[model samples]
Target chain A: MKVTIDDVVLPGDFCEDIIKAGEKSRVILGPGLRKELEKIFITKAGVLRKRAPNTYWVDSYQKRYVPARGENVIGVVIQKAGDSFRVDVGGSCSATLSYLSFEGATKKNRPEVQVGDVIYAKMLVASKDMEPELVCVDSNGKKGRLGVLNDGFVFKCSINLVRKILNPSCPLLNSLKNEWPFELAAGMNGRIWIKANSMRETIAVGNAILGCEYLTSEEIKSMCTNIASILAGHVS
Target chain B: MTTKRPQLPKSVLEMKFMRKTRERIEKELENTQGHDSLYSNIITNEMRHATGNFISESSFIFCEDLLEGRLSYKGMNPEIERLMEQDIKTSDPDGEMQKDVSDEILYKKMEALNKKRKSNDTPNKNPVLKKKKKF
Candidate 1:
C-alpha cells in the first residue's frame, strides 16, 4: 500500500512519496523506514512523520530500547566487568561501558562507579551482531551531563513520550519549570529520572509527565496548572 | 600478446637518482600492467558507475537534533543548570554576539581601524628614523 506523510503505516507498506522525493534529491530514511533496492518499506507500525527538507521517520510507541549510536540513554549498571561495566538499557543485550570512557579516568585512577547505579551515557557503538558500547564522557573529555545519576526516582514510559516531552516545542517543560523546582533526566531508552525537594513534589512531577502522554498541548497546559495548584495545598 | 610498458619521465629518472629507485619505478610499471590483465575479467562496468551517496545509517535517533536530557528547573540542581547554560552558550555564539551589526558596519569598522593603524605607524616610523639618524 502507498503511504504518505503522517499516515498510520504498517510493516511492508511502501512509501511512494519518499521514492518520488529521492529521485529529485537525497532523502533520509530515519528509524523505521528502510530502502531496499529501489523501494522504501516501513519496518515498524507507527505514524510516518516527515521533517522539512527530506527526513522521514516512524513515530512508534515502543518500550524496548534497541540501542542506537549517539543516543543518550539511562541504564542501570548491572555488573562490574574487568575493564568495562555492563549496563542494562532495556535492550536485548546489555551494553558495555569502558572504565576509561569516563571523564579523567586513568589506568591508575578508576571512576567510582558501582553496580545498581543509574547512569546517563551516550551509546558509542550499537550493532546487532555485537554488544552495544557506552561512554560517560564526550569527545571533549567532559562528562557534561552524561555520568552517574545520583538520588533520583527512575520510572519507565514509552519511548514516544520521552521524545514528545523533550521536543523544543513541547510546553510541558516550559510551564512546569516555573511551577516547581525539580531536576529531570529523560533518557531516550524509555526511562526517566526525576529529583525534587520532597516526595510529594517528585511524585507530582512524575504524574504530570506521565499524564501528558495522551493529552493535547492545550490540555497539558491546563493539567499542569491543576497539578501546580494541588501541590500548592489548594483543592480548587 | 605482450604489451609495451609505459615510460617514466626522462627528466626525473635522469636527475641524481639511485639505481634502486629507477628499478623500483620500472618494476611498479610492470606490476601495474600485469595486474590489469589478471583482474580485468572480474572488474565490471557497473562497479565504475557506483556512487558513494548511498549511506546506510543504523541509528534511529538523530544525535545532532536532540538536546541534552539532564536539565534542572529553577535552580533545583545548580550543577546541571550550569552545564545546560554552558551548552547553550557554546552551541549559539551568534545569538550571544552583537546581532545588529551588518556586513557594511563591520567593513566600515575594519576600514576605520586600518586608517588609525596607518596613522600610528607613520608617527612611530618617524621617531624610529630620527633615532636611527642620531645613531
Candidate 2:
C-alpha cells in the first residue's frame, strides 16, 4: 500500500514521500490525498499526480461529481426556495444559491432566475455532511462570467474530460477556438454548456470536445479540422 | 513551549519606572505557562497524533494548471471574451504593456515633430521659452 507520485494509487495507500516533503516545507495535498499521523493516505483509486512546489493529487476517472469548495460548476435551477434557489449540480443533493449572492441582488430585487435555467456558478460551500452551496458572484461582488448560462446546449461528460480540456496544454480548445464563433462554459462537475451561431457549429463544437477526450494533440488537431470541414458541408 | 517572540531586555524589565509594563509582560509569560500546564494532563494520546502537513484539496483546477473553462472566442460572446481578456491581463500584467512602443523611440519621435513644428511656425519666436521647456 506504499506508493509514490505518478503511481497507480488506491485507497489506504500511504505515500511516505509526501509526508517527508511536508515535514521539510509546506506541501499541498490536493484531492484524494489525505494526511494521517505523519503519513499521506490516498482515498481515491487513481494515478497519483503531483504539481510543482509540493502540490499533489490523484487523477481518478469519475462521472459522479462530489462537489468541492471554490470550483466553478454548471447547474440548473430546480426550485425557488424563498431567498435561495435549489440547483441540481449532478451531486447527491441539490446545491443552494442565495438570491443575495448574485451581483446587485437585494431582498427587494432578487435576480430573476427561473426554474430549469442552466447557470454557471462557483461552489461556495461543499461539505460532506451539509448540502453544497453555489454563488453567482466572486469576493468583490462581480459576476465575472459566473451567472446564468443563457440559451446554450448542456452536455454531460466524465469529470476527467473536463480537466483534460481545461488543461493549458490541451490542443482541443486551442485548435477549435478560431475555427468558428462559439462560446463554451465547462463545469468542474462534468457538464459543458456551449453556444454557437448555428446548430451545426454548436454540435460540431460538442462533438469535437467529446471526440478529443481520448485523442493525442496531433489527432485532436486533425479531428477538429475534420469536424469543421464536415460542418461546412465539405466532405473532408 | 518554543516561543518565537523575543524576550525584552532584563535591564528594561527591572527598571522601577517600567513596573506596569514589566508586570504585563511577566503576566503574559506566566499565562502561557499556565495554559500549557492547565491542559497538559487533559491532552490524550489521540489529540497529540501528528496528522502530517498535507492539505487536502478537492478541486482539479489547482492540481492541473487548468485554464478557466468559460470562454468566448471569435466574437461569439463579447461579454465573456471581455472577461477572458481581463483575466489574461491580470495573469500577465506586463504582456500587453510590453507590446507598447519603447519610451526612447517615443521621445525621439516627439522631439523630431517638435523641431518641424518650430521651423514651420515660429522659428525664433520664443527661443528662451523652448530651451526652458526642454529642461
Candidate 3:
C-alpha cells in the first residue's frame, strides 16, 4: 500500500499507514483484505506523479513564527518582576525586557515597564538547549516602542493566526486598514495581544487571525465571529 | 583529521534544543524516503492482526525494526464516537445499541482517565512562586 501526499488521507495518517503497510509486506506480499487496505491507500502512481523534488515535509501543523535569532518581533508584557518584565512572544517561553535595556535609563533602580505593555523587541539569541533572549535596545542603544499597552483587547490566538495578522497582504488588515488604527504585538511564544479602541476594531482584528493550517480571510473572519459570539454568550 | 565537537556555552542551550528536535524529525523523514513499499506494509499487517481493527487516520505510525505494539489510539477517536452516537440516536431512538461499557478493566481505565481530567482541571494552589529568570 503506497501512500502519497494527495492520498485523501491526512499527512500524519498517510505517514502512519505507509509505515504499517510497509512493515507487514516485508516478508510476504499476498492477498490479505484488499478493501480494508484500499480504504487507507490512494495509489502509488498518484504519489509518484505528485512528488516534487523541492517539496518540504512538515508536521501536520504549519510553521508560523517561533522566535529565531536576529528576528525582530512584537511581544506583550505578561508579568513584571524587579528590573525585568516577562513578554509572551508566540512560543512556549516568554521574552524578557529589562529596565536597563530600555532607551534611556539614568539609574539602575528606575521603573521602566509594568505588565500588559505591548512592546517591540529584538531576539538576540535562539537556541535549543537554552531559552530565547530578547533585548529592546537597538544598534544605536535607543529604546523604541516600550511601554504599557493601552486601549486594546488581549486576544489569545494560535501562533499561525498571529502570522496571518502580521502578514502584509492579509485581507483583514486591508479591509480595516484605516478603520482601526491600533498597535499589534504578536508574541513568538504563542500569544497575541491586540490593543484597539472599540470592541468593533478588536473584533475586526480578531476575525483576521487564522491558524489550523491554510484558511482564507473570509473563513477566518467567520470563525472569529462565531468564537466571539460563543465567548460573549458564556460571559453574558 | 578528527574534528572535536565544539563545546557550546550554557547560556545558548535553547538554541541547541530546537536544532536537535528539528534534526531528529528531518532525519526520520529522510530515512523513510528510501525504504521499499514492503517495509511499511509489514508493520501495518502485524498491528492490525494484534488489534483486530484498522488504524485510524490520526494514529502515529512509525516502524523501528520491532513490529511490537507500543501505543495505540483506541479510545482517542472522539470524532468517530460522536458520529456513532448520532447514528445510534437516529436509527434507534430507544437507544438499544448505546449500552455503556461495563467491562471491569475498561471501567477502571475510564475511572482513571476521569480522575486525571479532574485533577488537571483544578488550578495549582500556589500560582505565584518566583523562580530564577532564565534567558
Candidate 4:
C-alpha cells in the first residue's frame, strides 16, 4: 500500500499484513504525515458497538429541557385533550395549547385539532415539570400563525435541525425546493415548531433539512425563503 | 436626592437567584420524571450468568488467583487439566521460524502465535497481558 505523509507519498504494504494476520493492528505515521496519510489509509473500519434503544451510552444525568416562554418550537399532536391536545415537541414532556389561543371570533367555527397534526407554536409557559404552555399570536390578537394545523406530515429529527432552520440561510436547506405551505419556529428550550399540509411534503422538507451535510448561513436563508414562498402559494 | 429603599447585598441576591432556579428545576424534574429513574440499569442476558450466592472461602481464593494470572489449567482441577492436553502442541525449533521481527512487522509473529499451541513440556504463556505481582 502507498501512504502519503504531508505531500510526500511513501510506498509500503500496510493493510495486506494486518488483514492476513487477522488481529487488531495499528500503523504509526508521525505528526508530519498523520493528516495526509489519514486521507489515504483505506483499510481501517470504524469500530462501533451496537446498543439497545432507551439505553444511555454515556452519563445518565444530562437532560434536554422542554420549551419555555418566549422560545419558538415545533410540535406534533399525539393525542387530544379537553379543549386542547397533547403534543410532542422534542423534549420529554409534550406541550399543550387551549382552543382559546386560536385567532378569529366565530363561536360556531372552533377549529378542530386532531392527532398527527403538526403545528408551529410559541412557548408561553414552562412550569418546572408541568406541560409546556404554548401560544400563537397575530397582530390583531386574532389567530395569525396560531390556529388549526392542516396539510402536512409529522416528522421527527434531532433538535439540531430546529436550530439550523431558525437562523435561515443554512446551506442544507437551499439545495431543494418543493414550494410547501408551512410555518416553523424553534423553542429556546429545544423544541421545534412546524405547521404544514400533507404528511408527505412535511417529511420531505424535514428530511432535506436533516440530510444537509454542508450548512452555511446563506444556504439556510435560501431554504427558509423557499419554504416561505411555497407557503405563500407563490411556488408549488 | 430623596429617600431611597435599601438594596439586597450581592451575596443575598445570588442566594435568592440560586434558590429560585433550584426550585424551578426541581419542579420540572418532578413533573417529567427523569428517564433513568423510570428504567432499570441492569442488562439481563441469558448467555452470561451473574452469580450472587455465597461460596466457600477457599473457592473464592481459587477464583481470585485465576483472575490474578497466578492460576491456569495447571493450577485448577486435574480433570480440566486432562482435557486441555489435546489443545496443546509440543514446540519445535525447526518448525517454521518467523521471518520478520520488527515492531512494524508484528503481523508475522501474531500469525505464528495463533497457529501453535502449548503441549505438556514447556510452560504455556498467556497471550493476554498479565498484571505484575506487587513487590
lDDT of 2: 0.89
RMSD score of candidate 4 (Å): 31.2
Please identify model 2 stretches exceeding 4 Å from their true place.
A234-236, B1-42, B49-52, B95-135
* Candidate 4 overall lDDT versus native: 0.44
- Candidate 3 docking category? incorrect
Better of 1 and 2 by DockQ: 2
| Model 3 lDDT tens row, A176-235 | 434435445555434555645556655655555534236676765555555546544654
Expressed as tens digits, the lDDT of each residue in A1-236 for candidate 2 is 88988899899999988877887888887888887765778999999988888899998889999999989999999999988899999999999999999999988988989999999999989999999999999999999999998897999999999999998898998888878899999999999999998888888899999998889999998998888778778523
**Candidate whose TM-score is highest:** 2
- Order of models, best TM-score first: 2, 1, 3, 4
Candidate 4 lDDT by residue in tens digits, B16-134 = 55777566656865766755455435533431443322111101111111111000122223332333343233434466766657765687776667666435224444432243332
Give each prediction's root-mean-square deviation over alpha carbons.
8.6, 8.7, 32.4, 31.2
- Model 1 lDDT tens row, B17-99: 55677888879879978987898899766666554333445555662255568899899989899988888888887775665
- The docking quality of candidate 2, as DockQ, is 0.56
Q: Model 1: per-residue lDDT, tens digit, A47-145? A: 998877888888887888898888889999999999999999999999999999999999999999999999999999988899999999989999888
Full candidate order by DockQ, most accurate first: 2, 1, 3, 4
Task: For each candidate, give the interface RMSD after superposing the true interface residues on Cα.
Answer: 2.4, 1.3, 20.7, 31.9
Candidate 4: which stretches are off by over 4 Å? A1-65, A105-109, A138-140, A174-204, A213-236, B1-135
Q: Candidates sorted by lDDT, descending order?
A: 2, 1, 3, 4
iRMS, model 2 (angstroms): 1.3
For candidate 1, the TM-score is 0.77
